[model samples]
Target chain A: MYQKSPTQEWTSNVVRYKKFSGSWAWLLHRITGLGLTAYILVHINTLASLQEGPEAFNAKMQVFMQPHWIFAAWILFGLVLYHTLNGIRIVIIDFGKGAKYHKQLLYGAVVIGLIVFLWMGYIMFFGHAEYDFLSMIVTSYN
Target chain B: MSYKYIGSRGSGSMSWFLQRISGIVLVFVMVGHFILMHYNPEMGHSFNRVFERMQNPYYQMLQIAFVVLALYHGLQGVWNIYRDFKFPSWLNMAVLAILIVVGVGFGALGIANILHF
Candidate 1:
């Protein structure tokens, strides 16, 4: 049987490392970050319809107003929520004393992320249909 | 002889620090964005609705900042992830250049959308 040399041991070990909470967290953070980045590019391009005029933009947006697109947006929001919460945890661990309690921070982040994700899901699916009081603060077009 | 892969780049302490700061700002802006876009789909999807909001110069400025920061943070993140692996320096430079182009290109489009209002 061939064996890795001492110099290559560290790299091999990391590549074949066991999965744990921290590993999962790191992987998920990267995954969601990449997905969100890709989505941003697509979002920017999609909104370019505005340059073609209101009818063009409205027609483009009309496609996304469908239930399927709404569902997709909800899932996208889930990724954003997870990424944001974990980002906060990363900041705490790096800038503050959260390393000692990093696991707990991950747990807290997951809990809060879930709550926000579900709440946003509700809003994307149901709350958007009617006039929301809080929405009025930012939304009012003649 | 065993082959060892030493990275060919400097320690990116500045980018590391900025990533955290930009991430923090993104969270706040994203929250407000979610409220405005998701809370009322019409406000998000309708050009007239967004036009009304974009009429405010401050709001337009905020949106431009959002685009720049988001692009920077996201592309910088891709570079960070790439750094984790041992790639040839040319590939690294190429990837970095491409990320810059994507950031600038999409950034212009996002700003255009806002300015079009």
Candidate 2:
């Protein structure tokens, strides 16, 4: 097997690292957006299953309550909170809310993102499993 | 010296405006969505109720519009971001082509689902 010399390998790694890190923020935003959208579709599909009858819907909800799904839900919530809060930051910055306070606001977003993420994580982890599905779909259903 | 902005005039600005407008609209849609899908005891966990709701023309049109704006805005944003990278033009074209196809495909399917109701 042809092998790269240590010097060549180092340079290649540095180039790759620079390319990736340069766009890391935007890349993360896009990835999380895609992930969140996919989750939304799945969520809608699951709710659509409610058409099947009470037992079938209950069974599906049970699967959703599995540990793995719970973990995935928490992660998804964190991504959403991060993306939404950061998006607000972007919009505010666009409106010139804080030119001198740009970095401060960026840092504030990070902190707030973490806080919102923790709140979501807590609800997913410890809150009662009582998210009303029908109410989410329509007021008439009530 | 005239630096022509890529989005000076065309569908780009129109799409941008549509995205923001639709995004604001989605907030209301989602509020109604959560109330009907999650809170209503009759519809909350019942699949039949959901189908019945989707059968309404107003709801279906709202869904179609939502899906269209989302795809247009999202794909355009993604494509613009990709321009920042220093890649071969061919590679860029390939990526853009795939994105366009996927966007249209998903948007079509989402609308189709609404129309099916």
Task: List the RMSD of every prediction in angstroms.
Answer: 6.8, 8.3
The two-chain DockQ for each candidate, comma-separated, is 0.75, 0.23
Q: How well is each residue in A24-123 modelled by candidate 1, as lDDT tens digits?
A: 9999999999999999999889888888988998998988876667778889999999999999999999999998999999999988888888888777
Each model's backbone clash number = 0, 30
Residue-by-residue lDDT tens digits, candidate 2, B2-116: 2333323344656556545555555455446544632333454455665677778887788777677656656666665666566665676678778878777777666665665
Looking at model 1, the pairs that clash are none
Native contacts present in each candidate (fraction): 0.90, 0.10
User: Which of the CAPRI classes, incorrect, acceptable, medium or high, describes model 2?
Assistant: acceptable
Question: What is the per-residue lDDT of model 1 for residues B1-117, given as tens digits with 9 covering 90 to 100?
Answer: 112222344578889999999999999999999898888788788888888888899999999999999999999999889888877766766787799899989998898888887
* RMSD value for candidate 2: 8.3
- In model 1, which runs have C-alpha deviations exceeding 4 angstroms? A2-16, A129-142, B1-7
The candidate that achieves the highest lDDT relative to the unseen native structure: 1
lDDT values for all models = 0.86, 0.60
- Error of model 1, residue A70, in angstroms: 0.5
